[model samples]
Target: MLRLFAALPLPPEISRPLRKLQKDLVGARWRPEENFHVTLCFFGELRHTQARDLDELLGEIEAPAPTLSLEGAGWFGRREPTAVWARVRESDELRGLASACERAARRLSIPLERRPFTPHVTLAYCHATLLEDARAWTERHQAYSSEPWQAGAFHLYSSQKRDGGPSRYIAEADYPLSGFTAPEGMY
Candidate 1:
C-alpha cells in the first residue's frame, strides 16, 4: 500500500520568489523549499490496485486549465500553529480542477473529503513556537503577490514514512490540464 494524492507542483520561477520570502522569515522552522506544492486531494494508504485504477481514471479527465495566483498568507490551527500557508485567491479554475479530482477519486472507490477545499501551499508545520513569528512576518509581507502562473498539470504522489520528521513525497503520475500547454515539457 502507498499513501498518495494529486497536486500542482510549483514552478521554479514561482518558487524562486517564494524562496526569497523564505529568507525574510529567518529563525522560523520553515518547510524545506522543495516540499512546497498545492494539494488537490490526498489518498492515504491505498492498495497497488487502487493506485493503478486511480491513475487510469485521472488520465481520462478533461478540464480547462486555470491560472492560479498566490495572494497572501494564512495560518491553520490558530492555537497550536499546525501550519503556515500561502492563500489562493478564489479562482473558478482551481475549484473546478479540485472538484474534478474529487469526482475521479470517488469513481475509484477512494474516500472523498467532506471538508471544503482550501487551496494553499503549506510552508511549515509542527512548530508551535513559530506561530507568533509567522503572524508577524505575514503582516509585514502580506502584500506580496506572484505573477499569475498556469496550472498546466497535476500529479499523483506517493508519500513515504520517515523517522522523526514529515513524510517524504514522490510523484506517481501526472495528468495534463486540458487546454493548457507547458513550455519545454519541464513539469
Candidate 2:
C-alpha cells in the first residue's frame, strides 16, 4: 500500500521567497525547504488496486486553474504546539478544487476526510522552548506576501517518515487543472 494525496507543488520562485521569511522565524522547529507544498487531499494508505482506481478517478476532474496566495503565519496547537503553518487566503477555485477531490475520494470508497479543510503549508512541528520567541519572530516579519500564484496542476504524493524530522513526500501522479496542459512532449 502507498500513502497518497493530491497537492499543488510550489514553484521555485515562490519557494525561494518563502524561504526568506522562514529564515526570520527563530526558535520554531521549521519544516525543511523541500517539504513546502499545499495539500489538496490526504488519502492515507490504500491497497494497490485502490491506488490505481484513485488515479483513474483523479484524471476525470476538470476545473479551472486556481490562483492562491500565502499571506500570514499561524500555528496549530495553542500552548505546546504540534505544527506551525503559512495560511492561504480563501478563493472559489481553491474551494471547488478541494470539493472535487473529496467527491473523488468518496467515489473511490476511500475514507472521506472529516476534518474541515483549512489550507496551510505546515512550517514546523514538535515541542520547542521557543514558542513565544517564534510567535514574536513571525509577527515581526508578517508583512511578507507574494503575488497571486496560479496552480496549473496537483499531484498524488506518497509520504514516508524520516529519521531527523517530518515525513518525506514523493510525487506518484500529477493531474492538470482544466484548460492547462503540460508543454508538448513533456511529462
Clashing pairs in 2: none
Q: Which pairs of residues collide in model 1?
A: none
- Tens-digit per-residue lDDT, 13-66, candidate 2: 677777665654445577777889998888889988998999999889898888
72 Cα displacement, candidate 2 (Å): 0.9
Encode model 1's per-residue lDDT on 1-187: one tens digit a residue: 9889888998877776776666445445577666788888887789999999989988887878888889888767666657667887768888888888888889977887687799988876645446677678678668988888888888899988789766788887998888886767566
Kindly report which residue stretches of model 1 are placed more than 4 angstroms away from their true locations once superposed: 23-28, 163-166, 183-187
| TM-score of every prediction relative to native | 0.87, 0.85
What is the lDDT, from 0 to 100, of the residue 7 in candidate 2? Answer: 87
Pick the TM-score winner: 1
lDDT of 2 at 64: 84
CA lDDT of each candidate? 0.79, 0.79
TM-score of 2: 0.85
